[model samples]
Every structure is written in structure tokens, then in C-alpha cells.
Target: MEPVSLIVLLAMGTLAGAINAAVGSGSLLTLPVLLALGIPPGVAVRTNTIGILFSTFGSVYGYRREIAEEKGNLGPLMAVTAVCATAGALLLLASPGAALDVIVPILIVFALVMVIFQKRITAAIRAGAERRAARRGGAGSPATDGTDPSAAVSPGDDLSSAASIASAPTPARSPYRSPALIGTMGAASIYGGYFTAAQGILYLGVLGTFTGRSMKAVNSVKNLMSLIVNLAAASVYLVAHFVLRVEIVWLATAAIAVGALVGGYFGAHLAKKMPEWLLRGIIVVVALFALVRQVL
Candidate 1:
């Protein structure tokens, strides 16, 4: 590759990685650049998929503390996400591109709507959860899902965008069994597997609306889920390249990967440090950008 092209790829990859870690829609930055550089569509797709791993790894490390706290609630969700992502990747070749073009924008619109009305929706979900807990004799409640309530962060942080919820002494939990939460997450994972531009936004909307967790906490889990989905989908792509002769541009992949790693780590670092309001604003802004990008 020429030095100029190499420079461009790395730059795009880094920006995409950071955006993805912060609020998602990072792929929008990289994929188009790859195509513009004259990469074949198939090769660019596979290259971008594989390159995302480095970015995810960086973000995962950046959010390590929050992940450790939420580890118990993460396993089942990650497992389901992995399975869904694998299915999505396997189906990617057979699915019509036009169908995805139409469907994805609609999904983004719904996700944005959910985020916009997050407060009222979450209050209702929490109320419902409390009633269910009362009927079940208090096996689970809003603040405790078989975990220490003291360790929980307030859902209020979700909108206020407080400092890291890790520092907060609020109480709330991301429910493990809310069908809406889990379903949205699963759908996002599948979407991530296919292409992860705005998957983080979808996760934010779901986790934000149903789990009653702070944005930072929800964001930590969102990064983890994104990593898991990408890992699963990347595995499938690697297999296809080895056995089915699917193409990958190794040079482009390397450029994007290196750039993504740097971007993801720092983006996550910045996000973790931001006050609640700023983080919330970023999510809303990025989500809007994603919607516009898809619609156009």
C-alpha cells in the first residue's frame, strides 16, 4: 500500500474505534473509506470485521473495573450474544443487502425513540419489576439482583451522566430476565455481527430503559457485549476465509486494527472520566448521527 493510503486507513480506523467505544457508529467511519480506497466490497467487509477486535479489546481493557463488578450479570448475556452473533454472521452471505439497508435504519429510529423516552419507560419497568418481586416474595428487586445493593449505582445517573457509577453509592441492577432488555441486546448483537456501527446505541437504549443503571455502567456492559459479538462474528469470518475462500485484505486489516486499538482505549478512558451530562449528550448526538448516516 502507498504511504498516503496507509495513513488514511489508520486515521479512519482510530476515529471509528473511539466513536464505537464512546457511543457507536464507528464503522460508518471506516467502511466507506475502505471502499473509497478501491477495496473490494467483500474484502472490506471482512477486513473491517476482523479489525474491530483490536478496538474492542482496547475498550474492554479501559472498562475493566466496571466489568469486574458486573461480571455475575454478564455471563448469560454474553453467551446469548455470542450465539446470536454467530447466527448473524452465518446468515450474512445469504441475507439480502437491500433488506438490511431498509431494516437497520428503522431499528435505529426505535432505539433513538427508546433513549429519548428513557426516564418514563424505565420508571414503568422498575415499577413493574418491584411488583413482580413483591408477588414472588422478594426474591429479586430493583436494586438487588442477587448482588449487593450497596454496590449498585442509581438509575438517576443514567440521565444526569454522573461520574463513573463505580464511585456512586446508588442502588439498582440491570435485570437478567427482562425480555425486552435481553431481546434488544440479542438483536443488537446480531446486528453487531453483521456490522456494528450503531450497536452500542441500541444497547444503551435497551440497558438504559430497562435495567435502571447509570450510563457509564450500561456503557461498560455495552462495550463488553460489543466485544463478544465481534469476537464471535470474526471467528466465523476467519473460518470462511480459511475454508470457503472468502477474501480479506490483510494490509487494510492491519492498518485498521492498529488504529482501532489506540482509539478504543483512549475513547473509553475519556468516556469513563466524563460527567454524566456530557456522556448522555454524546450518546444522543452520536445516535442522531448514526440515524442520519443510515437514512442518507
Candidate 2:
């Protein structure tokens, strides 16, 4: 590679890594650059996966505090994601690409919509949970002055009711670890392994909706999960290069990896300071751009 081309690849990789660490779909930025530089599509994708492994490592290091807080919740899901991602990578290695072309755009659109309405959806979920708890409490309480138990509580007593709810015994298992969440995560991981564009956005939507984690915490988990998926896929590509004699552009991979490392560290720190609205807005705009680009 010429010095000028190498510099351009590194610059693109840095920006891609930062975007990925902060939100996701950094491949949207880097892959096009690689193609423009005359790298073959398959080689570019595989090389990019290798580069992302480094970027994600930096992101994980930057988000270590948040990761530590959520480690217990992340353990099982990580295993599921890794295993499913490997499967997806195998599929990618064996199959032709046309099948997913249509599906990808639709999924991206859905992910964008989920991000946009996340707050409202979460609020509705909380309201439903509260209503259920109120009904359960009402059933056991004795009526006084012929008043309905649910309606009998005064506004001032709401705090006490909430306190009682808080003091209720916690379940041994978190609802976040339910089969549905696991299945959804596995599916997303598979998609990530096969086609990575906006995979982080999909992860954010899933984690935000199901885990009810704060955006920062969810993004932290997103980085880890994405790392696992890319790592697994990259491993497959590495094996293919060795065993099947597939070509890999080592210079491009090195450039991206080095740049991504720097960008990931800074992006993680930046995300920590970003306001929720701004983070959400970035996710929406980037996802939409990715979606349109993919369709075109």
C-alpha cells in the first residue's frame, strides 16, 4: 500500500472505531473506504472484522467500570452471543450473500424505530408492571368504608406503597435472563457475525427494552457483545485464510487495528459524558444513514 492510502485507511479506521464505540456501525464508514482503495469485498469485510476486535477491546477497557457493575448480568448472555455468532460466521463462510440483502434493511429500520420510541415503550412497560402489582395488592387487602382497595390509597400514601413494593422479596432469577431475551440476543449476534452494519444499534434496542438498563450501561454491554461477535467471526476468517488459502490484506488490517484502538478508547470516554438525548439522536441518524446506504 502507498503511504497516502495507508494514511487514509488509518484515518477511516479511527473514525469508524470511535463511532462504533460511541454508538455502532463503524463498518459503515470503514468498509466503503477499503473498497474505494481497491480491496476485494470479502477481504475488506474479513480485515475489518479483525480490526474491530482491537477496537472493541479498547472500548471494553474504557468501559470497565460499567462492565464490572453489569458483569453478572452479562455472563450468560455473552456465552450465548459468542456461540451463536460462530454459527453465523460458519454460515457466512458457506453460503451466498443474496439471502440477507432484503432482510438487513428491514431489520435496520425496525431497530431505528425502537430507538426512537424507547422511552415511551419503557414507560408503558413500567405502568403495566405497576398496575399488575396494584391489582395483586388490592386482592388481599380488606376493604374499609366500602371503598375499593385499589382506590382507597390516598395520594400521600403512594410513597409507602412504593416502599412496600421495593421491600418485596426479589426473584432468584432475573427476568432479563428469560428465554425470549436469550433468543433475541442470539439472533442479533448471528446477524452481527454475518453482516455487522448497525449491529450495535440492534443490541442497544434489545438491551434497553429487555434489561431496562441505563443507556451507558447498555452501551457498555453492547461493546462487549459486539466484541465477542466480531472476535468469533474474525477467528473463522483467520482459519479460512490459513486453511482455504483466502487472501487477507495484512497492511489494511494493521492500519485499521491501530487506528481503531485509539478511537475506541476516546469514544468510550466520550460516550460516558454524552447526554441521553444526544446519544439517542446519534443512534437514530447513523442507523438511518446505514439503512439507506445498504438499500442503495
lDDT of 2 by residue, 223-244 (tens): 9898999999999989999999
Instruction: Write out the backbone clash pairs for model 2.
Output: none
* C-alpha lDDT of all candidate models, in order: 0.72, 0.74
TM-score: model 1 vs. ground truth: 0.68
Write the residue-wise lDDT of candidate 1 on 27-91 in tens digits: 65666566556565456666888887788899889889988987877677888889999988887
Backbone clash pairs in model 2 (N, Cα, C under 3 Å; residues 3+ apart or in different chains), count: 0
User: In candidate 2, residue 137 scores what lDDT?
Assistant: 83
Per-candidate TM-scores read 0.68, 0.71
TM-score of 2: 0.71
Clashing pairs in 1: 25-197, 161-276, 162-276
Q: Which 10 residues in a row give candidate 1 its minimum summed lDDT? A: 157-166
Please provide the root mean square deviation of candidate 1 (C-alpha atoms, Å).
Answer: 11.3
Candidate 1: regions farther than 4 A off: 96-174, 270-296
**Ten contiguous residues with the weakest lDDT in model 2:** 96-105
